[model samples]
Target: MDERDGKHQDAAQPEFRPYHHPAAGWGAAKSVTEFLVRERELVNGPRAIMKMNHENGGFDCPGCAWPDDTKGLHLDICENGIKHVTWEMTRKRVDREFFAAHPVAELAEWSDFDLEDQGRLTEPMRYDPASDHYVPISWAEAFALVGRTLQELDSPDQAAFYTSGRLGNEATFLYQLMAREFGTNNLPDCSNMCHEASGRALQASLGTGKGTVDLKDWEMTDALFILGVNAASNAPRMLTALAEAYRRGAQIVHINPLVEAASTRTIIPHEFARMATFRPTRTGTLNLQPRIGGDMALVRGMAKAVLEEQKSDPKALDVEFIERHTAGFAEYRALCEATSWDEIERQSGVGRAEILTAARVYCEADRSIVSWCLGVTQHEHGVDTVREIVNLLLMRGNLGREGAGPSPVRGHSNVQGNRTCGIDHRPDEAFLQRLAGVCDIDPPRAHGLDTVGTVEAMHRGDVKVFVGMGGNFALAAPDTPYTSAALRKCLLTVHVSTKLNRSHLVHGRQALILPCLGRTEKDHQRGSLQATSVEDSMSMVHLSVGMKRPASPHLLSEPAIIAGMARAALPGSNTPWEKYVEDYDRIRDTMAQVLDGFEDFNRRVRLPLGFRLRQPARELVFRTPSGRAEFSTAALPDVVPVAGTLALGTMRSHDQWNTTIYSDNDRYRGIKNLRTLVFMNADDMRDRGIRRFDDVDITSTARDGSTRTLRRYKAIPYDIPRGCAAGYMPEMNVLCAIGDYSTQSDQPLMKHLKVTVEASQPAG
Candidate 1:
């Protein structure tokens, strides 16, 4: 009866509709191809659409990192990349006799969608601890026990590695060429845990860590904004570029804390000639919401109400592009005219005429953009809330031009091409002198470890080998019982996945798992069959290849298990990891001789659908270090010592994606069945004495007083926003605290999280 089940919601709410979706966009690509043929058993439907656009193509859809719109081939997929290509072309597998019949504590109590639908794992395992399970080994004893623990580590900065932009671009350029030829730059990734505070506040305001618009910069924007992102379920084709900037007459606005229905409209249904000719599109013209960690006090009170409406209107300020291209305008206009309006309307719940009507739509936009995601880099002053949206787009003269700047929106599918093919945990000396002139050694320049300094250096034993190369890092890490006890005090962990998670049964004292190949299969190398390269979320860079074939037959190809563990750990390096896997254009000509808009990397990633990179905000160029644009110094407070508690936020569940949960449905907030639950604001859950389906326990504390909790859950009050609250994500990732992050890019502030609730168990 999934006739769009809870179709277009709002029946006094509580209506449900995800997992097997429908309300529109062509019944969401035919309810995700009928949940990929009746609940993900994907039997070759039209040979999976003729190998999803061939040319060696392996359906490049691991959800949202969106690019491919060379203004065509537009099925650029997203409802979590159609649940990551129907959960990787699922037809289920798990093999090796499903680990000789369960065990590993009964597959660590299932669910994470029944251990990823007990599928596609196939072989090469390890963790046996006397058959507690995970047997089959041999990939030459898993690269000779990972090259005898990187030649007994001692100090390659105690080995970390991490990376997980679903490793491609030739297994993250051969897993950062086996950690810079095993010398160190320890290499942490998952883009330093989600947009390293929008890449250190847009590479310190705008030299670029990437993102200065270009999805045709939302068609020459005249006003867009949209903060702390939810772009209709995390990048749903950026709701057709915010319905083409609300159909030409731009001005969209949005900001967030929850109000996402792709900001409001979107019914594409393959535009059935404008939905059987009814005509829809143009959504949000305002929206707002704010409050939970109030986006850096609501974008510095909309840049202090556009400098108090340009002090009695001096043409509402843009003073010749802030006096010829910006740089700290009079100490940020005297700290926004000595900040006050009752502390920016009680720390931004909005109203100083909605921050002076979003500062007169950014002073009547001449070209604007602003964008954001992971709700402004998951907070705690997320890089001063992304430099207060780059001080409200450099108080006019928005960095660069045509539709202005600051985009962000990245989340894998080459999470920004695994840090531009290096997998940096920090590394610059012109990318280690062009990787010491293409792998002739001498790489490490110190600085590494970032996913919270590699989980506080693996809980302080200074990490002894972990390696990931494909995430689910113990359920997208952050206090999942302290990241499964810092991955059971690692003494060698490894994963290189293709499915079967819960961090491969959270093992350690030596664990493995291998099982590679799955971008939708078929990779093959050495015998001529390669083609990788990723980079998206607008900086372009392309070429991918895999068109479904091997889900098994002993998988492989994460650049052939990182070049067979870098030819069994460096046995005298001189990298050519077998001539870049027999031609991935010699790893895109050695990642264009050590990366940076890859200097014509193999004829611009084979042109057709790749090549753009160079976005100094599309030419108006403001590479910061004083060649213009700067202005920050005015955001010195966003206080949050749980002042009368209740901030929360954490999200994900359009049948989930990150921390991959999938079905405990959240069909545009009319939840179904439930996945812990929480919501709030039904009169702030009746003035904090909460009720409707009670079962509390959310805790929080930290700043060293360590509190944390999470338990029972189930709150549900609804229409959030009064000092907000909301939940979901690796089961409320234990009410936040992987060192409650983001004091300039440590990034774990899982959408703010102040806490302080009571009743731990009531309406059972």
Candidate 2:
């Protein structure tokens, strides 16, 4: 039994058997089947919902932001996608009786998986502090309560609107519009926590925040460099593309602290012949395990090798492209030359020979693509590191062409769409002006708070009302204890969600749980089914039409709920909240008029695979102040090894999606029935006198001299860099300080936590 939540039934001694099977082959198939049976959705759920996922005129998978395959495979769903769909389509319901039987205090003690496992929320529920339980409340009453609270706030800045990436384009557009029209730009969102660094760095380097490549580029690339991204567990669909790239002999180099199993080899479940024979396809041609926060050094080393090769082979560098389309090359080249090989080897944990080998592959390739995820963007120098990657790409003239560019793979399905639809805390003057003209309202001109800023403001008593459009903000935010306490300080907290999560239990003095429809459920508006749109990682905007009946009749669509709140909050407002809710096309029409690159939104989005938003960077059109791509000259990060401490990074397990834990097992890493285990290098474990399954206390000291510790966590030895460690997030998030965020993007440095582990007890 796990003492933490008192629910897990696995053996008291955590299992650590190495998984020899290839990822997403038999293991994925079995996992999918098990989830279906567990959710009692083995029949029509998989047959119908699974087919609709990632297909034209079907609902998008509420999983990763990977672009859909235009080849239209019969089954495009991945194991995690199936898990998400089945998890949402679970038959279990959390109704009034369920809440009546359990008090909020009791529910708060339940584990995240157990709480969400209680299933879909049925109706709007309001917290009754006297009874310590949630009681059913009518939708109208809930809306009125939210409206009254917002209206009663001392200032509009006292309220912060939070958006999760799962929200669709139509709903997200309306959400931001409502917040702006209500005179507050405090629109803190999930992007602030995850990909803010990517956006900031890309916008600065290439004049565009999004990736320039589509799925088609994967097939055309000569070399693919994957950095700090674990595709198997995070975005399983990417495995298929990687396998194909491998078969086509594209040199793939995977660089990270841990050599992820999927990055080396993967079995594409959809490949019938390979699946029948159990043959795993090779993925990474070379894998580099660097120390945590050493990516900048590793990339700079590659640049140095390329520069050296340019001396001998003039073709090694695209001199003409750099001279015509880029600026600041001389400064960047000087920095690379000034940097020493000894410093690079010491910092990146990779030898000079290996760096040169990787550089040779990159230089020889006609076109190459570099892709990354949270690992690259969740560090103190995340923005600088990404800019370095852009520098490497620009040296080879990899941008503005097929099969080349920087790819920041997003985690959430519509996360990119949310930002595209104006879910930004700091909207530009042009965007705000367009929105104001389209909506016929004077929007707020002041910049709003991001996730970190919102938490700080709440703690300082500057914020009162917290409105979460979707997401488990309490658990997902860094410094879990601080965030929870900050949330409790709010006068009123509201969550518009499809299910009960930790954020619901960790509430304010007065809280409202406004239940909403999930992505798999049919959204009925004005007696007709409605479809929403989402933008994938490649900037492809496509419609998502749900087919299944809603978990409950009382659950309204996200757009409907936002409209209700807007109407109740601003009774005198002239925005057509009701009309937009009735016809989603109205939302699209207004969005096209407001946002760029959506000129023919309604008509174009209805086409076969929707439409690709115009990426100026892809067309070699730089919108930077220099009117060209800019090479960064930022100094390399200080990556010297600290005494008696290991750099730790938090990651999700195979059976997890963001903050939602599906199970305790991490299939790819071979961690079973446990989430509190810290993975350490064998050498480090031996040196520290810590054995496998030993209970160890991991502690981190914040810059403010405060310390956070995770007590009695099992320490497991694994294949990783000597001075680097890995652990599951949200559990390890406690060790991250609230102020420990990237200086440039304000994204929490979840991937560069400095921690020390001390043995608490030997394996029992």
Which of the numbered candidates is closest to the native, going by highest TM-score? 2
User: lDDT for every model?
Assistant: 0.73, 0.90
The reply for model 2, stretches above 4 Å from the true place, is: 1-12, 761-764
Please give, for residues 1-764, the per-residue lDDT of candidate 2 as tens digits: 01131124355656898777777888888888888888888785666645565555588988998888898787887999888888888888999999999999998878888898889999999999999999999999999998999999889999999999999999999999999989999998999988999999999998899989999998899999999999998888899899999999899999988888778788888888999999999988999888898898999999999999988999999999999999999999999999999999988888999899999999999999999998899988999999999999999999988999998999999999999999999999999999989899899999999999999999998999999988999999999888999999999999998888999988899999999998888888889889999999999999999878899989899999999999989999999998999999999999999999998899999988899999999999998999999999988878765888999999998889988999999988988889888999999999999989888888887777778888788888998988889998878888899988888899988998888888975445
Candidate 2 vs. true structure, TM-score = 0.98
Candidate 1 matches the true fold with a TM-score of: 0.35
**Cα lDDT of model 1 by residue, 178-233, tens digit:** 88778888788777767887877777766677777877767778888888777656
- Model 2: lDDT to the true structure: 0.90
Model 1 worst lDDT run, 10 consecutive residues: 1-10
lDDT computed for candidate 1: 0.73
Pairs that clash in candidate 2: none
Error of 2 at 763 (Å): 13
